[model samples]
Target: MQTEKIVNHIVSWLNNYATNAKVNGFVVGISGGIDSAVTSTLCAKTGLDVLCVEMPIHQAESHVSRGQEHIQFLKETYPNVRATIANLTPVFEAFKKEVLMEGKQDIVDMVLANTRARLRMTTLYYYAGLEKLLVAGTGNKVEDFGVGFYTKYGDGGVDLSPIADLMKSEVYALGEYLNVAKSIMKAAPSDGLFGDTRSDEDQIGASYPELEWAMMMNDAGKQETDFEGRNQEVFKIFKRFNNANKHKMNPIPICEIPNKFK
Candidate 1:
């Protein structure tokens, strides 16, 4: 889709949903990443009230600064956009030491990373509730469906997803059309959940374009023939991610009794 047309469509969709739901505006957590930057800009384009939240939890100074810079850009560019910083570092540390690490069961780094995500989630909801706005999610198609890289019920829980259908590259294209900050557009994609500043590809074992291609192949029910097959590594990585996270991609399962049992 043309970037401008999609941007307009998303803006209209946000306004329509807010009107139907009788909500005040949108609430987006800006994570200093292109996805969040694009999503927040989309919300701001609607000219409705938008809360661009920066919730940092033991984050790098550079990441936090980038988030603040993005917020400043939004406030300057859009009159209706508002921003606030919520530092969750102390809260996260307390919860980790006093609660999660207190048990005999050893918690993994993934557990701590997920806790950070959930903390940010709660912070977003807190402001959303105060303003009677909906939480706008920033996940794209590759992470939300293809890799399931987001934290379920953390980043995954949202009132609306404006960019979920777009692939990662498509998001960058829209970011350019939106004139998103060059720093953000050029920065490597990261969840910022991990304490270190590793890029998403470092953790995912493949770039988003590769992952997107794998998802496309999986959807088409095609597989490798042999050494002649294309992107076998990509297909393998995609399947590994999809299989591990398939439960998150689907709705919660429940017991279904048979007619005879009933």
Candidate 2:
């Protein structure tokens, strides 16, 4: 689809949902990453208030700072949008100490990471509820309804998603249409919980472009897409992240009862 049509479709679709939900607007986080950048822009353009927040942790040097620039752009471009920076280091530090003392942190890094995500989500919802707005999720098509790339109750939860069907590459294209700042459009994406820490690609072996391709190609409809043999790597990520982040996405495991309890 043409960029204009696609953008319009997204705007119209989201507005439909927002109107149905009776939200004041959308509350989004600007993480100095392309996904959130695109999401925030789209939400603001939809003629809804976009409450953009920058919740960075101790690792604020890399992408967090850049996200602020995008927020400024959003504020100027969309009068309905505004931003705030809420440092989450204090809470993360306290929680980190507790986790360290538990001695089970190694087995639960997933939990800790999701805790950060949930913290951001909590803040988003706090303002969203107060302002009667929907929380605009930042996950892209590559990660949409994905097996696992988000925290269950954390960043994954939202009242609406504007970029759920656009691939990372497509998001970049849209960024150009929206004239997103060069810095933000190209900045690396991170959860910001790890200072100069490894990103999703570094933590795993795959890159976002390839991963997005992998995800898009995986669909049976794209049978002719020819992803060119990244299946193993993609599956590996699928397996590893799914295994590690399972707790964040699934219900509590319960032993199967084969008619044992009457």
Candidate 3:
């Protein structure tokens, strides 16, 4: 891809979209990940008000540091960029106390992890509403479309997605072009939802590159029978996630009423 042209295109698109919507700018949740770093930078390039929010809930130290470093970098580099820390740890703890935790340990943990994402989503939207800003999404092609590696109505809830078309590798290229903080660009991709150091690869059982390849193969009408060994394993993993999380990818189903009944 022509990196400069792509960057300009996204920046222009963001500017036009905000202007058309009559919003001041965008609010992005910075998670110390590659996607958010690249996304927030793009928003800043539009020369509009960009608010980078850090909403950590039992977040790992590395994630917090990287998020702070990126936020600082944005503030120093872009006059339109500003940042705030919501620190949702206490809110999360309070939520846990009020909810029922009676389920299989793994299932309960999964629900709570998703809750963390939802809480962050709420925080970003709160700021967006208060400031007349759109909630900018930080999802990429693989996570948003291929594997559905996001929480529905959580991180998946957004007013605009600037980098959803770009692959993970392409996002990294944009990060390098945008001069994103080195610490963030080098850190392994993570959701930071679990409050631990496990990388996205650990949770997905396949790296972005592997998932990208699998997505391409699936798009090209390839099947599991066509692959052998590790390739087959990766394909299966991709298929499992893609099939399981189709709900996130598809629009919410609405029951249609028969015209005669009306």
Candidate 4:
């Protein structure tokens, strides 16, 4: 994938985009995940004002530690990089108190999990507005386009996505090239929205490599009838997610007014 060339390209793209937008820099939410680590590093490479924000809400210890480690690494390695901890736990708790919790347990949990992501999104934009920085997205191809694994108007809301074109494996390669912390690079891929140890594989019922393969097959016009056994299972999983989350992938729909009526 020409890791070195891709890194340079993304860095240059980021710098040019910020300059054209007249923004001082970027603000990225650090989640202690591979995508975020690689993304923040790319922003730092641009030598612009990169602010890495840690907004944890009942986050697991491992996630918190990895986030801190990466933020520290960025600060030590790049003079333009700075970090802050928003610690949105209290805000989250207060919000829960004010909202209705009446629903099926699983549904309620799902809503709250998405709430965590939205809260973090708000935090990132707040910093972006205050610092005149764009909100840099940390999504990759699989999550952003293939499975729609992120929260809409939450993690999905961003001013720019530097790595959205790269697949998960490619993002890992970039992480290795960027010298992201070993802890983060080795940790299981997770959205960290549930505040638990369940990995993305657990939530999606398919590992990234499996999903990547499924995405490719789908792109090539393959169908479920063409696969057998486990392959069929994976394909079904991928298709289910892709179909269910089409809303996240497609542009928001608008009701067009008739010109004659206007």
| lDDT of each residue in 24-119, candidate 2, tens digit only | 788887778888888888888888877898888665675866887888888888899988888888988888787554547654665677788888
Per-candidate TM-scores read: 0.94, 0.83, 0.99, 0.99
Question: In terms of TM-score, how similar is model 2 to the real structure?
Answer: 0.83
Error at 31, model 1, angstroms: 0.6
Model 2 misplaced stretches (Cα beyond 4 Å): 97-100, 104-109, 221-231, 239-262
Tell me the deviation in Å of residue 201 in model 2: 1.1
lDDT of 4: 0.96
lDDT of 4 by residue, 4-59 (tens): 99999999999999999999999999999999999999999999999999999899
Give the range where candidate 2 is weakest over 10 consecutive residues by summed lDDT: 219-228
Each candidate's lDDT (Cα)? 0.89, 0.76, 0.96, 0.96
Query: Which of candidates 2 and 3 is the stronger one according to lDDT?
Result: 3
lDDT value, residue 75 of candidate 3: 94
Clashes of each: 0, 2, 0, 0
Cα shift from native, residue 11, model 3 (Å): 0.1
